[model samples]
Target chain A: MTNPIVLDVNNLAVSFQTFEGDVKAVRGVSFQLKKGETLAIVGESGSGKSVSTKAINRLLPVKNTLIESGEILFEGKDLLQLSEKDMQKVRGNDIAMIFQDPMTSLNPTMKVGKQIAEPLIAHIGLSKEKAKARAIELMDLVGIRNPNEAYKRYPHQFSGGMRQRVMIAIALACEPKILIADEPTTALDVTIQAQILDLMNKLKKELDTSIIFITHDLGVVAQMADRVAVMYAGQIVEVGTADEIFYNPMHPYTWGLLASMPTLEVGKKQLYTIPGSPPNLLHPVKGDAFAPRNDYALGIDFVEEPDLFQVTETHYAKTWLLHPDAPSVIPPEEVRRRKEKYQTVRMGKACGERIGGGAIGSGG
Target chain B: MKKYIAKRLLTAIPVLLMISIAAFIMINLAPGDPTNLYVMPDATPEQMEATRRALGLDQSYPVQYMRWLTRALRGDLGISYSTRYPVLPILVSRIGPTVALMGTTLLVSYIIAIPLGIISARKQGTWVDTLLTGGAFIGVSIPNFFLGLGLIYIFAVQLKWFPTGGMLELGGNASILSVLHHLVLPVAVLSTFYIANMTRYVRSTMIDVYGENYIRTATAKGLTKQVILTRHGIRNALIPIITIIGTDLPRLVGGAIVTEQIFQWPGLGRLTILAINQREYPMLMAITLLSAVVVLLVNLLVDMMYAVVDPRIKYD
Candidate 1:
């Protein structure tokens, strides 16, 4: 049997030495991704989603960061142990990342074609003419119309969606095994977000590239994730297939997230909201990090921490409620109402798959 | 671009106008007249009054200003009260040494500071960074006179490598080579401050640019670290560096009085001092006005460089 895991991140913990004190950013966060899977890490700001990915790239400054413990074994090599010189080779060859703000991530003075060709020259050793030709091909693959003309244009000359396409083109330049997209569509308009999502889905299926998508929008998680890992206070609180998380959430934080998602509930007077803020990781709790924000906290939640309890073969939850002796609790009524909305999503995907089963083979 | 130039030039007018007014008022407002400067100490009051009338100081303040402004526009800085030579030629002759010395020093300092600053920001808190930053602090804290004396002690007094004072020996014909020898100490004195301060600015700007996401993206794209620095960081850093040089050029071009005094370089600073001691108001006003104009022109040059660094900038 083939080994199922493509990335094995075991007990990874990270901290930052700030002026006030040492802020423990990521506390023993762990997860795994299989080949050709999309694992969406959903969290509020400072949940360590970005930091964990940056650690994978080894991009955090050494002066401030301390990766206290853990291992990130990609293809069985510890990424943290590699020197910066070696890391440069891994960055574009094995793992590549695309940032949220496309405008700031692209060098304002460089041509779009040249930016895309940079990785090809670095990793693939392509000459100027060959790189240019391949850059045009990548642009065409990303669905930029008239790719030949687009090659001569600079970044500022492109529209917002088009700029992101250039960024996507640059990330896909070397065709790495894994792609990390951090809020790729957060800055885009509503309509553009859908198109970019579709593009990413199509690209992932075509390239067979395992993507770790970092986002806070649950709707995006539903649309794009093969599996969802809900993160809070730098730890994974829930992990399951997208169907499991949206249709049948097992964690209180996951319930809160589902309830607060703004959608087409037209006549509702007020949108549901999660009561308290995400825990401040600078000074985290002794027991459960989400307990203060969670309303259904049991007595044990204040004194002892929760561990990941298996819900199904593919699902897990880190909550005291999952214990055999604990009182049974249900996700709030609003989450039950939201379940009907996701039923429509499953129907739409099922219809899409039945209409063109062969088309699903190539996402385009 | 036209809007930017027009706005900048319009702002500069009032500044130059104020400089002219201040130079005008202060030169005439000083105690004692140029009359006593030309006369012997034993001269009678009538003789002093007569000398003052001959030089047109007896005219009304408004009249003195008009006559002064007219000759100033024509480039006739009045004759120096001390040497009785045309102030313009004395200034003109000395311009070569001052420009050469200040120009060479500023150029060399930038050449050293930019690369050093980029390296420092790249290495950031390493031993080399610590040592350079500490050295820059020492360069900034030590007084110009002391630094000058120390350098003279090293190269002149101790090693006997360069001349102690003057651009060339007193009787020797000035050549480019002879001129270079005299430039070493005074230029070194003046540049110690510019280099020290600019490196701090360069370091800060480099750090800021390096922190920008585009730089991280550049590294990820597999551009070598040096390419990331010189190609990306330095071009962005140039805006602030150029601004400093432009804003500070007047002081450099005119030459600092203290630094000029130490080395006895025949630059604008020494001429201003000589004019002041003899109370030559017209010559003083002219030199001050010229310095202000040169500074304004340099400001314009710096504005032009901004668009070159980041072409996204546009003026409506």
Candidate 2:
């Protein structure tokens, strides 16, 4: 049986009031997080991945941002119906969010220890001494050396990776049920990115915390995500388990995203990039937002929005190409080859596991 | 920190010396000798020459500056040419009223500005914000001399609520309460620009601080609005506000020149103007040097305050 749902967001829409007009940032987006699962929402910039997660925590600015519609149900209760006082209790206690830029996210004037201890004091109701002790412990947990000494230092003293580590430590302080990491490793270099991802993976197992990971990097999604959601223009165009999304992506937007990522494996000479910028949100689209960009666009795709079409019990894709009457079109050869390669690697690993076990048994 | 402060103090010595040299040269270059104001027009040429000799006015500029510099180095600013009294004593007596007026105005302006700025920023795009913005614009635009006179007309002449001008009535009781009573109009007049400046600065800074990513981080930490604002918002915004206040310190003393002249308040500003009017070379030089010193000291203090407020800013 699958893990139980911890947080469920349904048909959530968010709009930002700018001087020009009301920009509908997120529209009719729905998703659910399971306990201890890492659900990575992968999309390009301006795809509303970050905005969707920010809306979950009510972190959006109240002055100019308006929650247009929809229910954010955490546990059984609707989070949207809760008061600010009640939201505060749920925010750092039940859910915590880590931001993209570690440099800008941490307060420069405050000690890293105090910053880490903030959530503990606010949500866990820990005394200063106890919170500080826990903060140091968290620092050590995130692999910061001499965490006790490092705790007293300001944010500038730490390197970029170390600062990101501190950010993770702060988020993990309260041991919340859900952790929302919004492009957490995007600002770091490749090596540091791997280290942070590894640390987060370890923490997920240790804490059994569900993570909603938002990223534009498909490579990061491959490593860290259990489930993947491909968002395009404020909507999830495809949702499935990691294997299904990678090995058998159905939506044209998902194909564009995957086609764009560089791989060591042989592919086309030039990188495939989606043509045209995202549509301006000042004026909402009438039909499929990606219809203009899709190379395999059906005539009906431009006039009507397609709902999620079920491919498997756990996989779904929103595209007109999935219709029964639509002409058959094969995935690009490079994507097919990559899928085959992934299958071969997995089969080889399984085969090796059994042979190694048998060889050990015979030797014994 | 001690080393930083010591180094700053060391640097100030040369700065003050340069200021003294500049002030001495500028005052001496100006026309209208102090002897002209002191002597009678009908006095004999011999009498005028004798008076000039006694005052050392006939000496070379270098010779006179060197003499004054030597006395100043020994903590004496020399005797005033216009009054013939010791310059230090006259300055010592006059500085108190200026300090009280400026200090109270500074305190009141900050006390009023900080809250209004915060509230204005919080209530941005609201009627309250618009009203405060309108008020700040008006406060910044009004000429202090005109405002002082207008206040005198309304409160002193029309309503008879306050004394028109001066720190105190001649021969009035020298109690602190009575001094404050006399201070009402002048303080209000002096504070207008400060309030206007500080409130606008603080409002912009607070709004900018509110947009900082750390504020979102603070909010994500489940902090109350009050805690987030005080701990994150105001703390960071305070850096720029302190800067504005610090750079405004020299102006605080200098801007008082016009206001002091209009009210005839017995302060260094009025004294400086009087020295200029009467060609009190020694007194003018002394006041200019003192103003420069105040500016340098305030800059040092502001730098120290930066290290205190921002942990990332180390004095090393």
Candidate 3:
């Protein structure tokens, strides 16, 4: 049987009121998180990947933040319409979040064990003693050795990687149905990033928890994502299965994202970069937001925004090049090379042999 | 912790020694002589010389300082040049009143300021915040002596609701109620400045703390606003607030100098002024040393409090 959908976000729009004007941070974004699967939203900075997920849990700042339009559906209830009092019941209990910066995410003054126990005591009405017992168990589950000894220590006593594990322990303390991790490993070193990613992958299977992993790291996306959604300028430009997005990316933006990944080649002169900065969100855009940056921009791309065109039963892309009437443009040679390399790695994995390189490193 | 305290105390010795040397040199260099207070203007130079010899001012600076230091180390601060009694006892008697006044003012100001600061920070940019911020500016700007006189004139002279000055009613029985009656005006004047200062400090510190990532984490944990504020906001804000409180400890004596002068309160501040005017070098030296020691100990206490409040700050 197919896994059920746990979270359905429809047409979500979020904005921030600043001195200049309203900043449309997230403009009409939508995605689904299926139960027991990992959905990775990949983008560059300011692509609104983080904002869309934070809006799901209602974790955006109260002041100056306006959710202009959206519906976050969880368990047949529109979370947007729920009062803050009811929303509290959902946060950290039904849905938990782990932030990017581990050093600052956990309260420095409070003990790590107490922090993990906070949600248990708040939502489940567990007694202090019972919560402490459960918290120690969670610490052990997150691979914290000597959980009893580490319980009394503060966040400052732990290293960056250890603090992130503590954050994960806190997020998973209440057995949340959906865990939104906002770049959870971006701040960690490469080796530590792999370990945290591995821990998350292992825990997701053990607990059967759905996850919305937001990051700009494609290597991490390759390792952790079951489904991938490529966001550009606060909109999902392309989305498909992990294999489809990495091996057969359709949108020019997705092509740039994959081509930008540093390959293990002997004499590649420089990495390909998408030219031009992202469009400023202070003012509304009349047509396609990425037209100026796209080298394959058609005349209509600058005058009219393209809707998502169906490429396959499971894949969709928002680019005019996929139109039947449009001329077929060839993707760059680097894009073709990456797909071939990834296919070879996949074949190696099937034969019980491991291949290590960029973009497809440590495939889960 | 014990080792930290001992190290702090050891370091304070050199600081105290430096302050003492500076005070002795400055006092001796001033344009006045102790013998001038004793002898008549028409007296012969030999009579003045004899008075200086008896007071040991005839000796060199080092000899005089060494003699005073030796006696001071023995807990004998010498007889006051003005009062003719021992300096330490007079100081001891005055300590009770100053402590009572300062302690009450600190308690009252914190009681008023903490809530006001939290409210001002919570309701930032609202009318309540604007009003408190404006009032704090005025309170901080207005001199304490002026505020004290204004309070005495309004509440004491015209309104006649509370006693004008002193720690108790004149020739009346020394009861708690009577002392409280007299404490009203001085406490009001002194605490106004403290409340204004602390309210602004707590407001800004709390505003910064509210923006910390931990607060967002607290919110994500589904904590109510009240719990988030008390548990996460205030506790983190308290680290900087404690620092300001420690720095303000020296202001107890500094603020009291002018406040006590206006209120005619029987405190060391008034005694200090009297000693300075009459050139009671022995009494002045004793009070200065006491203040220096108090300041050093207060700094040490503040350091200890840092360890208690923030786990990141481990003394050991």
Candidate 4:
């Protein structure tokens, strides 16, 4: 059974009023985060994945950013409509966020324990001593050796991976219902990235907190995400279960993304890259924002913006290719090979009867 | 930390010695003899030589420096040619008034500028920011002498609200009130520049600090705007601002020459100008040495403060 929805963002549009003009950063994005599941929003730089998640907690800068339209429904409240005073109570208590670039994401002047204790003191109204105790506990929970000693240390004293763990500790301090991690491991080493992802998975299971993981790395998505939302040019182009997005992605952009993944197959002449850059958001997008870059763009994609068409009960793709009247096109070879490899692995596992039935069922 | 301090202090010895040598040489090289004002113009060359000898100016450069350094080491800064008094005692006496003036100026400037700067950074492109920025620019651009004269004219001369200048009102009792009344115009002039400078520095530094990822993290933690600005923003911004303030410490004794001149306030700046005009070698050298020591010590203090303010900084 599906977990209950913890966060429902509907038609969220955000724009930044810059000197040139309004740059539409996030254009009509919608997604639901279920309890205890990690929902990864994957995209290239400036694709609005970070912006959308930042908007969830109303953390966007007040001076220039304008939420054009949206309703961030959390619990029974529309967070967008809540006053900043009320929103403060919701933030770090009901919802918390961890940012990328652990090197700069923590206060250099503050002790790590105090940074972690800040939310607890501010939200839970814990006494300083109690908060310190809890903060030490959290430091330990995040796998920091000698939590008591680490607490008194500053961010600079910690390594990049350790700093990120401190960041995660700070985010998890209040036992928040929703944790929005914006590329939490992008700035870390690859091996450390895996460890952080594993820690997050472990924490997610232990804490039962819903996570909105924003990242550009698909490998990270495969590691931690229960579901994935593929963003492109300020819009969610496709969203589905991890299995569907990897094995049976329908959107051309998704196909391009899957094709771009480097493989170990011998004599694969060159890696496939999606041709052209994302559309600039300065001027209004006339039709499909991705039409210029999309090799599989139909004639109608040039004149009309395609709606998110349903593929399966749990899958949806915003592309004209998903329409019934549209011409059928085959996915790239790499994507098909990936799906076949997964099926073979599944069959092998099934025949061995070593893995659980539930694990096999969940793979679909 | 103690070792670091000791090392810094040790390094300061050569630095102070070099400063003393430079000051001694520069003063001797300057036009006019210290004996010029004492001796008659038509006095014989032998008489002039006698006056120079008595004042210890006839000695060779190295010999004179050695004599001065030895005497200074014994707390004897020599007698001032102009005052006929010991240079160290005069400098010590002047320190009180100058410190009072500069200390008040620093306190008043930081107290006013810090809050305004924080407000300016927080309110950034708004009209409030524009007004404060414009005011700071005016404060920075205007000459302190002119500002001093303007205040003297309006408050002291026209309104007759305060004394025109001096550490205490002429013929008045040396009460704190009288001293404060005399302090108004000079302090106003001196603090204007500091307030303007510090406000701009604090504003720019804080604006940059606000952009730091930790600031975003603090905001994300749901701290109030005030808490974030004070705790995160100011705490981080303080690193550079402290450097600015620490560097300004030398100015306390080195004094605001123009401001002191305009106000006629009894401070080291006034003493310095007087010494330069009359070629009071001993007084000038002492002031120069004091200033160098202040600068070196302040540098050490600021470096040490960095360790206190930012745990990331290690003395080692």
lDDT of each prediction vs. the true structure? Answer: 0.82, 0.86, 0.88, 0.88
Candidate 2 residue lDDT tens string, B79-160: 8876679998998788787888788889899999999999999899899999998899999999988998898899999999
CAPRI quality band, candidate 4: high
Output the better candidate (3/4) by DockQ.
4
Interface RMSD of 2: 0.8
Give the per-residue lDDT of model 4 (tens digit) for B1-316. 9899999999999999989988888887888877888899899999999998998878888998999899999989899887788888899988888999999999999999999898899889999999999999999999987888889899989999987877875575799888887888788889999999999999999999999999998988989888898789889999999999997888989888888888887889898899899888888899999999999999899999988998878887
> DockQ for each candidate?
0.53, 0.80, 0.67, 0.82
The residue ranges of model 4 lying beyond 4 angstroms of the native Cα positions read A266-268, A339-364
Candidate 3 displacement at residue B87 in angstroms: 0.8
Candidate 1 residues lying further than 4 Å off, grouped into runs, are A1-4, A143-154, A337-364, B1-18, B153-155, B173-177, B314-316
List model 4 lDDT by residue over A171-270, tens digit each.
8988999999999998899789878988998999999999999988777777777789999989999998877788778899988987886645514568
- Give every candidate's TM-score on chain A: 0.91, 0.93, 0.94, 0.93
| Residue A211 in model 4: lDDT | 94
Return the candidate ranking by DockQ, descending: 4, 2, 3, 1
Number of the top DockQ candidate: 4
Candidate 2, which CAPRI tier?
A: high
Worst 10 residues of 2 chain B by lDDT: B247-256
TM-score of each: 0.90, 0.95, 0.95, 0.95
Question: Candidate 4 — which pairs collide?
Answer: none
Q: Which should have the higher DockQ, number 2 or number 3?
A: 2
